[model samples]
Target: MAPARKEKPIHSLFAGATAGAIEAFITYPTEFVKTRSQFGGKKEGPITIIRDTLRTKGVAGLYSGCMALVVGNSLKAGVRFVTYDSLKHKLADKEGKVTPARSLIAGLGAGMMEAIFAVTPSETIKTKLIDDSKRPNPQYRGLIHGTASIVRREGISGIYRGLFPVMMRQGANSAVRFTTYATLKQFVQGTMRPGQQLPTAVTFGIGGIAGLVTVYTTMPLDVIKTRMQSLEARSQYRNSFHCAYRIFTEEGILRFWTGTTPRLARLVMSGGIVFTIYEAMIKAIGGREDEQ
Candidate 1:
């Protein structure tokens, strides 16, 4: 008998990265709006914020941190997909079949890696652009230009202003998101019984629930990340921890969840889209395996 073909980690990584890049590119303006709204103020709504940002910063402003977003999101997606697959396989080997909890664990590991390596710098640049309409002296025309400007002015350290909060938020967010999705999928599959397929509406419903859960759970860390990244040199808070402490002390606990409304909305919409797309991709790829 022929040896069984093994799934390649790199293939999954590349595919996920490509998908993530596309998704990020498409939704980056919303992300820009989300970040700005998160850090800016409670007064202006999302639409108003977007309008003001475009009026002041123009078209380029909408895509202020495109490069950083693309690169960071790509790496994050690559690491997340690859790590999740590898860890799931290993866990399955030991425990027999893959389970939702196991998938969550895998996602946690992937999220930590991505947060530490990919989220910090990109977020820093993004936050700077969003918070400040004063186009830097020379004006950072694009992501590359902005990154270079940050590096030149602030040194290597500047690129990671909100590293800690990002790590904490994304780690927990990814874990819960993946776990909920996995568990929900299992629950849906179970109801259907042997050889049954879950309906599309059911899939979307489960994904939306998982997304809401993650957003609420990770709101505080997300607030801290946005605040830290938005800081200027003249600003008080020096780092993520300090920012979190200051916000808690000054603004109280509720301050940490300032943008919960928009964030929850964004998470629900984005999460549903991402999972649906991921499922579709997996099915397409897995089908080829079955045919072979």
Candidate 2:
């Protein structure tokens, strides 16, 4: 295919939304398992997690808060890419080349914006649904009821229980992700002829690699965020720092990486799928970026 035409900011947003929905639907089961595993101390591996979840809640259990997650992710993705692109435009040099620092800054900003606006509240409900699934009797039937229940019990602030950790996790996540992605994408394009489109497989591979790097670098924060959010009350760890301290002292430092396997699998697949779909959708929508 020929190089795509230039794109506007709105194109990035739309492409991100489309990509988010597609990736979330496909990888949600892994996400559910990852969250469960993050609680740590259960000898159950990913396979057992899947088996138990299936046995108890059925296949639908694997998708408990899917719609809420999907919608939230859709909005978050849009905001993330849009903010990144806008920041990139401002930060790029005269030749329009973005340094690693600038790219990371843009990604951090994008992640923070998305986390504050969409991720915190969305994940609050999503985690509640997932946590509830293990209960003998699930309290919230679905997304709507779950949201209402949280508000009723905890008030508006309830939905933002893990806001600080979420911001930190997401900030680090996108910063590493976009920086790696941009660097790899540049290398990939450098190897090809001018105006030649990257193959779909290559795009996915690069995205997968970026996702892996992002996950490992930010795994500790991610674990803390999950622990903070998963609890219905503040009884367990107190705050993010205390959570980290307790997990370190009691569970050992390794507990910070409790969910690495499922998370790695989910994120790698999600990154590849999301990036591939995002690029394809952007191209289809007549939104294009200059060959870097």
Candidate 3:
């Protein structure tokens, strides 16, 4: 078998942005519901949450913060896939095969960079917008104003309220996701005929499984991140550790899995869509390093 080669970083970045935007557009409502369910102590079923949101805030509520999310996702996924591809390419052995360990390292690095640069601020604004929907007097008017408000009130740090948990979550999320998807594809396509592409169904299935693994593995941190980002001025929990401790002691450990329903749905769909499009884009761009 011939070794795979790296594609241009610009290609990877553009591919990531396109894939992320597509996924965000199609599945953003699920994400909205996920954020709503993640906040608040009581567990509300998906139906109840949806009905409540629709009844109180109207259909538009389902798409609240979607614009911000789209922009954020574009940047986040762009940076993530680009970083992963560059790192994996650099780390590949002489045979041009990325070992599982190397793949994992690349994924971790990508996740960390994306979380720090894109996810934290985007998520803070997105979550705040969604959480504010039910308020009698909403604090934020829109994306630009909301961002300005956060900066003005809490300084630039306000936008990064959940940086630690987000980093932990994204690091684990990308590491597990990329490693699992790549490993599974490699195993499934053990020795493909030259120029043979993995079937779309197979890619989607593998991606879904990868998403499930990522969500379950990082559920606790995800919950904590939601809480931290969703906070307004209330310092309910001191830090990530304190937040976890408080959630555990007050809301029970199971609360750490809040919004699993919408999250699972969103992720499963997102993983499949994003991976499938990204792979297709890479193929279209004439890149052979398809594993990661």
Candidate 4:
């Protein structure tokens, strides 16, 4: 398979969107479980959550805010790769090599761009819908209805409630995820012949490892971001800082990892699927560095 970075930004964007759409649809149940688990206690474990959601709302309940997430994540992933490669292309040295610092810079910029443009609003709507699901009379019906209700009641700013923490989480997330994946891929390639492409399984393994590394590194930020984006956030917390403070004080430090298991499960699968599909797509496109 071709290195995804060798693809033109437009091709990467298309590959990424395709990868993200498939990944999001497949992994959305885990995401619903993760969000629901974040606000629930130990008693509401993954199995219990699934059982409850299925019992009350059926399988559709598990996909409560899926469309929003699918669209948002697809767009986010596309922009993320495009922005990362574009910036990396600019920052690469004369020999077409990018240093660790430059790689980090590119990843950070990509994550932030995706956060502002795609993640914040979609996440806010998703979180609200998931939070609403627990209620006897769920206020929002689906993505369109949920988004409309949020905007009507709270205006456009409602959709961007968790902008700061989302940016922070995404920044740290992509920075660590991309860097770790690159380093791990480079290490694997170094052990092989020059220009030898990695096996699909190996690429998936590396991506999963990178995702595992990212989850622990930024779980706290994710916790904060979830809380801030939830329906009750306006009444419960003042801002991102206050949300962090409350979680640390009232909820206890370990509570910040409340939904780690589900998130870990989702991201590990997500990283692998996204990268594997992306590389395959890029390879099929027959992309090379000069095209950029």
Kindly list the per-residue Cα lDDT of model 4 for residues 119-232, writing each as its tens digit: 998899889989998899987888898899999999999999989999999999899888888778877887998678899999999999988988999999998999888877
Model 2 lDDT per residue over 35-84, tens place? 88886455567899899888987998899889888999999999998898
Residue 25 lDDT (model 2): 86
Tell me the tens digit of each residue's lDDT in model 3 across 1-292: 6656676788899899999999998999889988888886567778998899899889888988898899999999999999998898899877566878889999999999999999999999998888887687888888998889889988989989889999999999999999998789877877777657799999999999999888888899888898888854255777888889988988888999888888899999999999999989988987554344
Cα TM-score per model: 0.84, 0.94, 0.95, 0.94
Q: Candidate 4 — which residues are off by over 4 angstroms?
A: 1-5, 40-43
Error of 2 at 199 (Å): 1.3
Q: State the weakest 10-residue window (summed lDDT) of model 4.
A: 1-10
Clashing pairs in model 1, backbone N/Cα/C closer than 3 A: none
Q: Model 1 scores what on Cα lDDT?
A: 0.72
RMSD of each: 3.7, 2.5, 2.2, 2.4
Which residue runs of candidate 1 sit more than 4 Å off their true CA positions? Answer: 1-7, 40-43, 57-60, 93-101, 134-138, 193-201, 231-234, 287-292
The clash count of every prediction, one per candidate, is 0, 0, 0, 0
